[model samples]
Target chain A: MRDPGNSGHPDQSGHGQRGSIEALQEHVDALEHQSKTTKRAHQEAMRRERQLRTHNAVLAQLSMNALREGCDEHVARREIVTAAADALNVSRVGIWLFGDDGQTLRAVELFDRQGGFARCQTVIRADRYPRYFEALRENRTLPAHDVHRDSRTKELLHDYLEPCGITSMLDAPVRIGGKLVGVICHEHIGPQREWTLDEQTFAGSMGDFVSLSLQMGKRNEMEAAIKRQREYLRQIIDISPNLVFVLDEETRFVLANKALCDLVSVPHQELIGNSAMNLIKDQEQARRLRKMDEAILRQSQLSIDCEESFTDRDGKQRWFHLIKRPITSVDGSGKQVLGVASDVTERKLYQEHLASMVRELDHRVKNNLFAVMIMAEHTAMGSNDIDEYLHAFNGRMRSMAIGHEILAKTNWQGAMLVEVINSLIRPYVGENLRHVTLDGPDVMLPARVAPAMCMMIHELITNAMQHGALSLEEGRVDVLWKVEDQTLHMNWIEHGTQDVAQFPQRGFGMELIERTAAHQLRGDAQLSFEPPGLRCELNIPLKLPADRHE
Target chain B: MRMAINAQLKDKLKDLRVLVVEDEFLAAKSLETSLRKMGCEVVGPASTVDEALAFIKSRTIDAAILDINLSPGTSEPVARALRYRNCPFVFITGYSNISVLPDDLRGCLILTKPTDPVSLAAAVGQLAEHART
Candidate 1:
């Protein structure tokens, strides 16, 4: 430690007071000079102590004001630097705080006494000034007189102190939580000033005030960060379309969104603290939801997916798929059930309809197969040769196939009678559909009836083209029908063809027509041979068979 | 032999008037032909509510046969009309399920279509015998 008392070296020639009268007179003068220096030193000490006491009181008051008003930390730090600069009568004083990592000091509040500047932001690196860094660790203050000549501060001689005309520095380390966190720097410019013991102590008190401000600033930043995160998380939850809710230990809703509120058919105020089981009428569903909740909480599992049904406000049953999980705070505040439920009623209905569609398709296939069997039997009975039988069977199959193609396109709902007629004649009509005149009232025929009617129409047209009106280019067929007394009286008249006597043998076409009328339609048939062509008029049913399901 | 017997049955049904309410045109005509062969004059084979209601308003029917499931709706109104007129009727359907009939008509004679010709003849003969009385 450098002694302040021994500074400015005692005069070495003042010790020869033992010999001459002039020497003796110089000795008396030396004694007076020593006494005057001692008195001046004593008075300076007393003045510094008074200044140190005032600085401490001001620092204490500033800290108290900061705590009471909760003002900005930088404002409190500025007040501290101003008080320090006044106490030392220094040109400038600054409070430098360590960064979070503590590798450097940030000059947070700098006050220039002459200019009265409150804050001048600056940075100091400990790595570049090893001697000052080491000195700060070892001493309360450098008391750096003639800063260019001091061992610790000479590192800043040309770069900082000398350039700025700063001849002296009184620096005191500011410690927080038992580590050196920062410093209070007092700079004297124009002339070198030896730092008194009281000035060094006063600088240390100002450093304490800055440490308090730093703690408050850090806390405020942390709180602000946490609040932002919470707001972000809450927004994400509120915007979700699913029924998001938090349930208490008793399964009462403690928090809910619009979706869950709409589910219970209640306003948010009424929904809170209400048990979900009370809203669902189904006892089994309530029990299942309760059990699932237990699984989540008791098993300490993350989440579970489940489906449940409940009656809606509209009195229709609605299905919901729930994915719920348990959430717990690390501090063990309480356990909560965080659940998200989506409406899956339409999905369930589609699945059931898909299954029924498959069943209906099965029934349709079976019914058509039975009709094919009956048609084959009649065709086989009428054929005289194998080739003839095959030809007749193939023709009948093609007619049925064409009929089903139209029905299946409509999902087996049914085909229009007109559509069935057109499909069967397309092969014979070629490019122009106008060749065959189809005139009839629109009839929505059942899927079961299309194939039979298709076959009957097929036979008439084939016979007409081969031996009747449709055989000639100019010839045309006019078909007409109407619903009268529930009987569809369809007339198939061929206009032009070669005249011939009736065949002796009744072909399958004739037999199929007469049988279908008698058995399926339960109607009578008439075949008349006029000169122009044959007229086959049959009165058939306009309704689905009693055996067919609607 | 069945034709000869059916003609003989027609002697009993001669001069009787009957109404048929069937949706299927061919089934209606086939029933009409049977009723005609039995010497019963047929009034109508109504396919819908409006047609059947019209026939009921105009005609004085002795008996009727009703198809249970008809287009536009079931034949309940026709059965109600026949009941108000004191005309005995029977229902016909290919469906074996008797549940399709209304609660009041559960006891009514219902013929399963593609029915045995003998049963149909038997039911009509019985209805004719009751009508004469």
Candidate 2:
């Protein structure tokens, strides 16, 4: 409250007035100074606010850039190093990852403000720098203005600090899934730089970014490895000749090899997702196949080496030896069945055919034995003495045995018609087989025909020995047969016979020839009676009698 | 001694007339001799099914011996012919099992031949005695 008339200048007032005016001027100056100081402080605070907003924007952009692409975890790591240096405005920045042992810290990446990121070789030994390592293990960030003097970092004084002229460092631990994996280092050069709270926080954020990128990188690596392993297994299964397959509970095919597809006569793409029931055309066999699969599904383990058979669309029997194992997901949520199968159709059919053949052999042997017993008894009756019986029985038995030998050699399928004639005459013929000539177009006769023909040949040879060709040294019997008009016309001609003796009566040979021809061979037998010696002609049908077995 | 035994053997079927119906020629010849030695008059030794049936139809047979399967057919028709004449006969077959015979001749005294001499004589002697009664 100064007087309104009083001048505000000290020179305009007397001593007291002057002193009061000076005091007032001093107060005014002090107030003006205070006002300017307040305005400057306000401006300083506004500039700092603008700077902090710029840093936030830059860091946010850096973070987004670091996570730009998936499976780019390592790429993101390199980005983190470069971005950290740029964001903090530091000369050098490095990331160190702890090895598995956790004692040695090897630098993974390094970035210079002047140079881009490069592979690093910086390693810190935890054992050698005990205090420093311990301090870092306990604290999250170690911001040092004087790195060489800080107890948490003094181990770098002589070797790292003096050499590179680094006066300050800010480090933050990068943790992933609650495990400390690595550390990010912000190193300042030349002057010892005092780290502000903003710079410290930024460094800590970079640590978080590093740990995330590393975890992401490991995940990407694991996924790629899994993908590669799955492909290898798929290739192995596809190329294998074994019918490899997978199925769901519905009996639908989930996956099958080319072998399975080809066996079912369907293309690979069309075969998948098809039911097993659709592949089998036979209802009886299809039911059996379904029973086996249902049993496997019911037993939640493995069903190994079971044989299954079914008929295909072509009316051919198909056989498989199958093995199935149930596979479940780790969580036990999904059910899949793995199957390996072998095609055993040929083996199974061969066994069945062999069994039928064995039965046929049994029936044939029994009938043949019956015929032999009758033959032996009748031949005995024909015999005047035991010597006659032995001689005739031996000859008949020899012919029968030789016929069986030829048949056995041919697996009982049939004997050649000429071979049958030759086999019976083999024992009777002298060394060369030329005495008894068997002539015909080579025809094969079934097993049933062989025995009847053998008995006929036996009777003829017996007659030849007694009354016909071979009775004389010079006489020869020529057996010539021809297939004419679907009939076997065989003529037995006795040659070089000096005595043209006619038969006194129709004997056993004639009667037997007639019986065998008419009943067994379904043919006609004629004794021409041109006899100087016997001339018998047999007109046998080319095909066997329908019920010849009886 | 041999002459005495043959005489005794001949007298066993003295005045007996027997028919031999066998298909096998040698078997018929052997059987004819066997019947003759027993002092029985031999009838036709037919070698076929028709021959056997014809002999039975034409002749007055005392007792008959029939082979079951005379080739070209079974001895069924021959058996029917013998039965029509009220003739008692025995069957000689290669089949040992009696079940395999025709239903008409299932229980007929069937013997597996070459005929057992004792059985053939006994059967014929019994038939001869039955004829006398």
In candidate 1, residue A241 scores what lDDT?
67
Report lDDT (Cα) of residue A536, candidate 2. 83
- Cα displacement (Å) at residue B100, model 1: 14
- Which docking band does candidate 2 fall into? incorrect
Q: For model 2, what is the alpha-carbon lDDT of residue A379?
A: 74
Candidate 1 structure quality by residue, lDDT tens digits, A4-76? 4334424633443233447658878999999999999999888867876787777677768754455677777
Question: How well does each candidate superpose onto the true structure, as a TM-score?
Answer: 0.58, 0.69
Q: Estimate candidate 1's RMSD in Å.
A: 12.2
Q: Provide chain B TM-scores across all predictions.
A: 0.88, 0.85
Clashes of 2: 1
